[model samples]
Target: MKTNFDFLMPSVNFFGPGVIEKIGDRAKMLNMKKPLIVTDAFLEKVENGPVAQTLTSLEAAGVDYVVFNGVEPNPKVRNIQAAKKLYLESGCDSIITVGGGSAHDTGKGTGIILTNGDDITTLAGIETLENPLPPLMAVNTTAGTGSELTRHCVITNEETHLKFVVVSWRNIPLVSFNDPLLMLDVPAKLTAATGMDAFVQAIEPYVSTNRNPITDGQCLQAIKLIEGSLREAVANGHNVEARTAMVEAEMLAGMAFNNADLGYVHAMAHQLGGQYDAPHGVCCALLLPVVEEFNIISDPERFKELAVAMGENVDGLSTRDAAELAIKAMRQMADDVGIPRSIKAIGAKPEDFELMAENALKDGNAFSNPRKATKAQIVELFQKAYDAE
Candidate 1:
């Protein structure tokens, strides 16, 4: 075990059924007068959606706000620029992001550009920001991604078809809200994908090169929660208990990954998301077992521990055998929750594997993968995911 490491999380987090009602008061406490609410068009369009509910709360609290509903599923650099423009024009003093990872990522990019005065793409690597950002709050509408609590933001470069990860403690939201009520309306497929995304977040970090005791404990707890609650949350979106557990699991996973970093699964998934415009969580789900199978050779004991954390029965099994069981258990969970069986099933083409694999090796998260992979190995991994059924 390493002697030193750091763990990061948002300063304040509110979790429960109706904790979103506190957003207005929280904004006031931050001295934010006219915050920009960043979100996606779907939320803005849906009747009585999460964004609508947030707006109602802000109104009741008498907190002036403006809406920027231009975020996309893979959140492009253009989205950040557009939101930043709106924030400046609206005279917004702060930001409140209301959605999943995409919305929060867009808000983070907007804050970066607003503070650093450059194109968002200029700050796309570890600890790149030199200026402190304006106050920002995250109102999570999904029990996945946990972008609300993390210091990392992923933004796609629309022109280049590449996803860039920006990591900085400065990007952490000033406050975060996880209200299960906001997650009740998510569609089943999305709920399944996102829940699996959270699961991968926990597993990857548990076996990451940067894994420490603190993150191990968090990842274990997250894996247990996901194992116990993800299927129920996906199958019955209105189940508050399941939703709350999933939310907590996601947040715990976020804290683990935020400090311990991630692995090739996230690295490869980001490429698919940028290239195919695929859902991030679905990409994570399809690639997770494949990546972990490759990774198990590096630390079978840790993988075996992960199997135990994921609630797999590995009685009388060798370490390597139990490690393999972890991948099998994850695959079964994905199947039970309706995640697509393969990358090919989710619109990924084998012809693009070389390019994506090249980019995957360059991704920031790739640095912490339990296994150090060559470009050829990454390409083989992509082919394996593509050919799996």
Candidate 2:
């Protein structure tokens, strides 16, 4: 363990039902008279959706705002530029993002460009942002991704078909909302994918080389929460208890990974997202077990712990055997949630594995992986995931 580490999160967080109704008051408290609302077309268009709820609150509080509903899946650089242009043109003084990772990331990237005065791609590395962002509030619409509470902004380069992450304390939102009510409308498939995303986030951090005591507690609890609620949440999105557990789980996973960092699952999954335009959560679900199979030898003891958190019966099993059970649990959870078993099912081509592996090795998250993998090994991992049953 390191001698010291920092725990980071938004200054203010709201959880549970009816918390979203407080957005207007929170925005007013922040002196946000005029703000830019960043979101996707779906959120903006849906009646009585999170965006509509936010607007209602803002209107009641006498706050004026302009909406930018151009965020696409795997938010691209141009989305940031466009949102920035709107923020400038409308004289908006703050930002409120509504939706999952894509919308939140678009808002974060816009904040970066507004203050830093450059393309988002130029600020892709860790702590590269210099200026403090304008007042920002994240009104989360999904219980997945946990973008509402993270300092990481992942934006895709449309030209190169690569997703790049910008990590900075300044990127963290000033406020966050996690009302499970917002997630009640999500489809089962998406619920499964995002839940698995949270599962991967928790597991990756638990075994990270940078793991610490604080993050360890958060990761294990998050794992337990995900294991207990993900299936029920996916099976019945309207179940308030399950939805609440999942949102809390995702937030905890976000907090842990934000501090402890992640490993190969995210590094490789990001490549799949950029390469095939695949859903980030599904990509993560597909790669989680495959990557960990290569990494378990580095710390079978940790894997055994993970198996327990995942509710596996490791009684009387050796460390290595229990570690293998963790992988089995991961696969079972994903399969139960309807996630495909192989990357090839999502249109991944074996021919592209080499290039994707090279890019995966260069991803920032790769640095904290428990096992150091060469490019050839990463390629083999890709091939294995593709060929997995």
Using TM-score, give the best candidate's number: 2
- Estimate the TM-score for candidate 2: 0.99
lDDT of 2 by residue, 1-389 (tens): 55488899988999999899999999999999899999998889899999999999999999999999999999988899999988999999999999998999999999999999767888888999889999899999777798899989999999999998999999999999999999999999889988999999999999998889998999999999999999999998999999999999999999988888998999999999998999999999999999999999999999999999989999999999999999999999999999999998889999999999998988989999999999999999999999999
Tens-digit lDDT string for candidate 1 (298-341): 98998899888878899999999999999999899999998877
Error in Å for residue 172 of model 1: 0.2
Residue 43 miss distance in model 2 (angstroms): 1.1
Question: How much is the lDDT of residue 205 in candidate 1?
Answer: 89
How do the predictions measure up, each by TM-score? 0.98, 0.99
Looking at model 2, the pairs that clash are none
Residue runs of model 1 more than 4 Å from their true location after superposition: none
Highest lDDT model number: 2
